[model samples]
Target: MTATPRAVDAKEILLTWLTDQVSVPVVSTRPDNKDAPATFVRLLLTGGTGRHDRALHTTQLTIDSYAPTTAAAVELALAVDAAVHGAVAGLSPVVRVSGTSPSESPDPDTTSARATATYQITTRLLT
Candidate 1:
């Protein structure tokens, strides 16, 4: 008998991975604290796709790197890109990772500088 496939929480998997791999704090949303760390990473699930006949899922994630300076933010973004690509071999659920739209920009509402990148990740669903 074939087992049923289950939905994969890509955000949680990545959060755990980035938290262990990156130097800065990794969060799904911006911290509510007024004194939040100057350097941090935020992960957002933009969109995804799932195959009806296959136990495979693809997700689009936007990663925002925030720091005190634009250059620092950009550097952090690059680091995140590298980390995500480098660690794929160890992450079983993750089958592929493709990145795009790396840019350096500052947050408008806050003083922190922001750099952004989008990654398309394909994963094998657990059954």
Candidate 2:
């Protein structure tokens, strides 16, 4: 009943936290992968009530590779997602990733050699 508003508020709070993400370093040495260090992350989280008892939380996060190539953008996204999942796992209130659809947007500065992109992530939160 009253939990509906609470859920929306919680979603907003999480959205705010994600949109203003900070850059973190990458330390992966996989032979087939050269992870690109993250530069920045922006999230556009939006969602509300849904069918049945299921609630949804959708977030569109963006990342900048600084000077890496398209390949780098992917590694950065992984690191960012890992960091995000960890933080959410330790959230005060319990929440889970019911479903997730992550995609990478084309580079903004196509002319530049540096790689940069925005990730659109749709995450459903079932209450």
Pick by lDDT: which candidate is best?
1
Write model 2 residue lDDT over 25-44, tens digit each, in one string: 32212112334333433343
* Superposed model 1: Cα runs more than 4 Å off: none
Residue pairs with clashing backbones, model 2? none
**lDDT per residue (tens digit) for residues 31-80 in model 1:** 85877998999999999665534777888899999998898999999989
Against the true structure, what is each candidate's TM-score?
0.91, 0.45
RMSD of 2: 9.2
Best by TM-score: 1
Cα distance off (Å), candidate 1, residue 71: 0.5
| lDDT (Cα, 0-100) at 52 in candidate 1 | 39
